[model samples]
Target: MLNAITITQIYVPDQDQALDFYVGKLGFEVTNDMQFGPMRWLTVALPGQPDRALLLEKPGPPSMSEETAAQVRELITKGAAGGHLFFRCDDAYKTHAELKAKGVEITEEPVDQPYGIDFGLRDPFGNHIRIAQMKLG
Candidate 1:
């Protein structure tokens, strides 16, 4: 039986920059840093959360098809289109401000939703992304 998906791979141009975003801005816990030859394997997870992790690694040779390159670059540039992290918070308004104070980009402001508060932004690498805090009954 498959228990769960443990990690996700995100292609980035700069490993350090991505680390800063996932760690410094998003407050994810660092897991491992392994370097072998020209490859570096760094993984991080959210505090108190370990079932999933973010894999920061370089993309394939740029010589790949322009279309594929465009898609990867788009994922890197805008943030993961399908990446959504849920944060449990007391106040979404304060969370938004805190992120702004950290110089984190706020591509969209918080808006009330049937399920909760949803707003999100991109890391410097452009992974389509968001953070949400679900509302109560």
Candidate 2:
């Protein structure tokens, strides 16, 4: 990043369920889960990759204006996001194949970029997740 990878926020219906899926299934670690009034701030980070954290929270917070929250909720409901939030993979090709074989909803096939190789997968919650491997220089 231009500075550093912080938390990539994701809105979820249930934070506990999200933790079960991302943490229990995908092997992410629970970094932060705390409450401040009616809202809770939850974050998860990968073990091997900890530079960034994933924020799991529901819609609505004093931080966001009602109009902005409404727009974000609309985007989340429509399932049309700007781009994907990627997950690093050791072998992008094989991982993509295995995921496809397991009936995971894949958005795109592997594409080789100048800096890396990656493929996109859609989570159950409509979050586009990219799995990439760095291309050798």
Candidate 3:
């Protein structure tokens, strides 16, 4: 039975840049960084959450043909790759301000919702991310 999600993958054009953005900008910690033949396995997880990690994968070679990889890269750059991440924070306003101060792009300002406060942003690779401070039951 599938009990827990272990890892999720998002295609990135460059692993190093993605690493810097996810770690340096978003404050995610590196969970794994190793090379396997032509592929580099890189993963990052939020602090204190190593049970689930996000794989910063490059769409190429072992995964797909060069032609297909090129197409995927184009789609990713256009923000049409459909890569999205949703995160929960203790304080959405504070988190948004902190990320903005770090020079991370803020696509939307925090706004209150029925669920709580939330905002949207984009990763360097055009992946959409939303952070929220959810209301507790």
CA RMSD of each candidate after superposition: 3.2, 3.2, 0.7
User: Rank order by lDDT, top first?
Assistant: 3, 2, 1
Question: How far off is residue 74 in model 1, in Å?
Answer: 6.0
Which residue pairs in candidate 2 collide?
Answer: none
Could you tell me how far off, in angstroms, the CA of residue 65 lies in candidate 2 after the best superposition?
Answer: 6.3
Model 3 per-residue lDDT tens digits across residues 102-127: 99999999999999999999999898
Candidate 3, residue 77: how far the Cα is off, in Å: 1.0
Residue-level lDDT for 29 in candidate 1 = 83
CA shift at 108, candidate 3, in angstroms? 1.1
Candidate 1 global lDDT: 0.76
- Scored by lDDT, the top model is 3
- Screening candidate 1 with a backbone cut-off below 3 angstroms (N, C-alpha, C), the clashing residue pairs are 76-125, 76-126, 77-126, 78-126, 78-127, 79-126, 79-127, 79-128, 80-127, 80-128
Inter-residue clash pairs, candidate 3: none
When 1 and 2 are scored with TM-score, the better candidate is 1
Compose the digit string of candidate 1's lDDT tens values, residues 1-137. 98898987767768898888989987888887897555778889988777788887666443456577667776656555444544567777888899999999898999998889878777787765666778777
Model 3 scores a C-alpha lDDT of: 0.94
lDDT values for all models? 0.76, 0.76, 0.94
TM-score of each: 0.79, 0.74, 0.97
